[model samples]
Target: MAEKEFENKVALVTGGSRGIGAAIALRFAGSGAEVFVNHRKGAGSSKAKAEELQERVALMGGRLTAVASDISSRSAVKEMMETIGREAGRLDFLILNAARAPFKPIERLLERELRDLIQVNYMGNIFCVQEALPLLEESAGKIVFISSLGSRFFNPAYPLGSMKAAMEAVVRDLAESLRPRRVTVNAVSGGIVKTDSYKVLRQHMENLDQLPEHLVVEAEEIADVTAFLCSPAARGICGQTIVCDRGMSNALQRF
Candidate 1:
């Protein structure tokens, strides 16, 4: 692929301040696309990381703009899309990578936790899609949701799985509904990615360290596949959730 394959294009990645979202932002920016990295609205680690990502992209001669928004709020999402339009004029890719949920069983979740689980992980992402629809349709763009194996398999304390599952269903529905408009919708179900959150998960699922080295999936690997889904190569694929888990999801394993 040419270094500037996405020249003049624009992409927005939610939760792009760190981890898989950060990698995806770098991937698109590295390919010469102007990227908008979305972080939750606040000053703290998330904002710091977004700034760091911006500097890194600048060092690489890539363009990135950090946008702050709480996707759970429809009003915030709307303002974000408006900002992107006013600044970038067009959007070619929308990566639904933002998610927020506590690590705990569904049955044990408190009222607040339950609301957050549904609001941020599920409704928040859907809100982005709804807000970005106009720009996407104008550009006939692509949308990719960042999902996980938790959506299919039962994890020790992963209530987030239910939301991922729901978003995957939305992906299917949107793919069909947006087909005529040439807006493609898809997802990537990652497996056991060693992100910052992994440290927290380790406390609950001690066996994560026991998985074979070869089974570990890198953030960049997921980003590469995500880029493919947004490229011309994936024009034929729609309403599909591609699993980029390094075969970890193929069968049961003894830890």
Candidate 2:
């Protein structure tokens, strides 16, 4: 509950260039955590924007490092972990926020689409956790995987929902398995975050506009919850998916 509670702690946030990941990265930096903002850079990637973010984060008081690695690649993840270990001997927090997917109907899913879905959404996170284990073990690190309402509430066109749901299960499983080691695992299933992803999602789901303004979840709100989960105050909580949707999940089927 004190200011700069994360002083000297090390945190890694995937997809931290913008949106919820950005909010989480800034939150950690502002709280005095050394932040590593990780992004994927290649064709059509936001390498420029990510670099700009790196510059902005460096201006903050906390130590900041902008890293680019394809989470889907085992070698890339290994290299990323090596860099972190070389620079900072330990990692205190690993926020799983990066997600790459092509939103489409499940029925129309192609072989390539399915493979990528597993690679980027599911296996990608697995690789991060596996690679981060050593550094995290050294520090008893906290892990928070960002999820969405689609994981629970069915979205016909939201193909990423399945992956989100799968990670939540992983969170629960790892939370118990790693408890003896002092590591914590949890998930935050946000609702209707109006980020750039939402813009793309709107094209697939028309009902987005119909949701009440009060039901929307903000990136900063998600960031704060995530920060709390990583803090000592939340040590009592684990293996849970905290919903931050302004009661939106209960708002449906209104009279």
Candidate 3:
């Protein structure tokens, strides 16, 4: 791919202080896009990660800005959008990568916990898109949501899965609704990723070698796909949940 595929474009990645979100922000910066790395908190490792990304972009002669905001709150998201508009004037890509939910059985979860998950994972995404729609439309941009295979499979029974399923539906509906405006919306559903969020699951599973290579998708791998989806190369794709699970979903069979 050309180095300047995303030249003159601007991207916003939520929860971009570390892990997959950090990787996505770096990839965008590498591709010559001005990236906004959004984190909910501004302390400790998250702050360090943001600083590291800023340094990387500087070394690469790219543009990167780290913004702190809680995506689940409407006022915060509004403020974020306002900052982007003021600073960059327009947005070419929006990656909804912030997801928060406690790991627990459905019965054990309190009503507040479930609502929080829905608010952060589902409504947060909706809010980001709602706030970013006009800018995206102006730039003919794309929106990518980082989803999980849990939405399709039966494993990892948590309230998060239910929220993911609902979010996928929203992705489809939004894609269709935004089609007329030349704004594309899609979800990249990944398998078990090696991130802090997966530590709990890793403890229960033994013999990692038994899993397919594709099943262990990396942060960089997902970041690459996200960069592509934001580029002109993915203009033909829209309203689809592209699974990056290394055929894990296909490998499962039932009689």
Candidate 4:
């Protein structure tokens, strides 16, 4: 096997307590990245789950810390970034993964619901990038936004898709502006990964079964691409959204 590529490096993954986020955090830990796992509030963050993950990473001989913060709040993001600074001193990777949405059609969403969706999914990502920039500057870090197929395809039930698409645009802008600072930015647009979020999606989508088994990706598969985006080997790739859907987007129906 290969050596731990992330040895001695440090990373922060938002929504790191569960699903694709948890998988990403563990992959970083497995690669020897001291990870700051950020879990959000309400139905999002879970202290118990975070603690469990920390223990598992510890067993792997890697360090991991779980911090509960509302990514939609500037103050919370600041506090979390500050804590990482004091303890870790530097940050090598920022994984924008924490997100909240009603998992319903846009027409069914209330005004407040739409506002909250934008706040947590779009603005929250900006808050993390802005606050974590100092530490990222110190480490000349990398940022990987955990996007979804909804960003590109028609997912009327998935209200959060717009925000994901918006962030992908931001990645392109940031990639150019932050180039002088050597802080690369990118995104991973994942397929239908069987996560808790998927469970919610299932309630709204009638054609979930239309997807073939081969096209349905695993959480760890997305994690693998995320980790690669942070690796030295990906230095040349910037401002890009690497689609990891196993070709699910390539067709409508199969024989």
Candidate 5:
């Protein structure tokens, strides 16, 4: 693809301050799309990381807008979409990558944790869709939710899996429901990627250290797949969760 394959396009990547979200934001910016990097408001580190990403993009002669908004708030999500519309005029891609939850078993979750799990992971994404629908419909946009292997295969102490599973269902429903409007929705369920969160996960899932090196998935690898999903090459695909696990999920031994 050309460097400017996505020139004149606009993309919003929620939770784009770090990890896989950061990678996706950079991917779109590198492809000549005006990118919005969304980080939670009041998160100093996250905001700083987003600024760093913005600087990096600027060095590449690309534009990246760092928007601070908490996806969990309906009002915040609406304002975010409005900001995008005002600044970019149109939105072509909405990447749902924000997630908040403790690394604990479902049984051990506190009421607040459970509320956050549902509100941020599941409902927060729904809020983004609801708010961005108008701008998306205007551009025949694409929505890609970031999911995980834990959603399908149970992982020890990973409470976010249930929300991932739920959102995958939404992906399918939205794909069909919004088909007439030409707005496609899909998901990317990544395998084990060594992001900052992996350090914490390693403490709970000892097996992560024992997994074969070849089974590890890189953040950039996931970004590449996401870019493809939004590209014309993926026109035939819709409402599907494309797994980027390096085939690790295919081997039963990993479980």
Candidate 6:
């Protein structure tokens, strides 16, 4: 119905089978980008969600391929990138949107659990970036990491917030290193979003009523900001964490 913004670009979105990742994949494809949608396990894992998205892309006359891989593994990430290079020729955008964690209290979290969190959320990101750097450099691409407000504020429900904080540091460091190469790196920290992940905390949604209707961020909203960051308009805006929390971050706290 409308002109697409990223007509010639090729994008790779990790964990894109559903929720925020799904929204990002659809948005990029809608904007005319050839997208590589990465997911782990089989289609049976997410069922019709992956097929639904693939069909949507086809209907829009956009190119997309859904691949399955465990990003926490270095060899898996390497093979994924190799496939993209061979098929897409070059990569123009990377969205690290996949993460895993178990809800537990800080003291209750096992050392093994912490290690798993680090591997999936932090180390997985590092591996993806490193493997994709060559193609990204060739295209002067944009890399967007999907973080959360938990990285900045205390969320007792999610003991894995510390890993998000670590990722914020990674974003800054990577941005600085990639500056000379013309590739931009940034993190999008979203507030409470309505997604399958949020279903676990739906009980708290009522407590958020005091905030604006828009304050409850949606997956698509995050997708929109992410797409903008990957565009030419965001070329000068690098090494920054853009908070898409609908001003929730600015509200004064009550004692």
lDDT of 6 by residue, 1-255 (tens): 666799889999999989999999999998999999888776585746777889988998888898888889999999999999999899999999988888766777889997888899989989999999999999999999999988888766676578888988988999999988878999899987878778765443345546556678888999999998998888788778899988888866821
lDDT tens readout by residue for model 1, 1-255? 455779999999999999999999999999999999998966988889999999999999989999889999999999999999999999999999988878888899999999988899988998899899999999999999999998899997999998899999999999999999989999999988889888888888988888889988999999999999999988889999999998887888746
Q: Give the TM-score of candidate 2.
A: 0.95
RMSD of each: 1.2, 1.9, 2.4, 1.8, 1.3, 2.2
- Report the C-alpha lDDT of model 4 over 98-206, residue by residue, as the tens digit: 9999978889999999899999999999999999998898899999999987888788699888888999999999999999998999999998898888887877887
Q: Which pairs clash in the backbone of model 3?
A: none
Looking at model 4, report the run of 10 residues with the lowest lDDT sum.
Answer: 40-49
Candidates ranked by lDDT: 5, 1, 4, 2, 6, 3
User: Best by lDDT, which number?
Assistant: 5
Taking all chains together, the TM-score of candidate 5 against the true structure is: 0.97
Weakest ten-residue segment in model 3 by summed lDDT: 200-209
**Which candidate, 1 or 2, has the higher lDDT?**
1
The alpha-carbon deviation from the true structure for residue 251 of candidate 4, after best TM-score superposition, in angstroms, is 1.4
Error of 1 at 92 (Å): 0.6
**lDDT (tens digit, per residue) of candidate 5 on 120-213:** 9998999999999999999999999999988898877899999999999999999999999989999999999999899999999977899888
Model 5, residue 148: C-alpha shift (Å): 0.4
TM-scores of all models? 0.98, 0.95, 0.93, 0.96, 0.97, 0.93
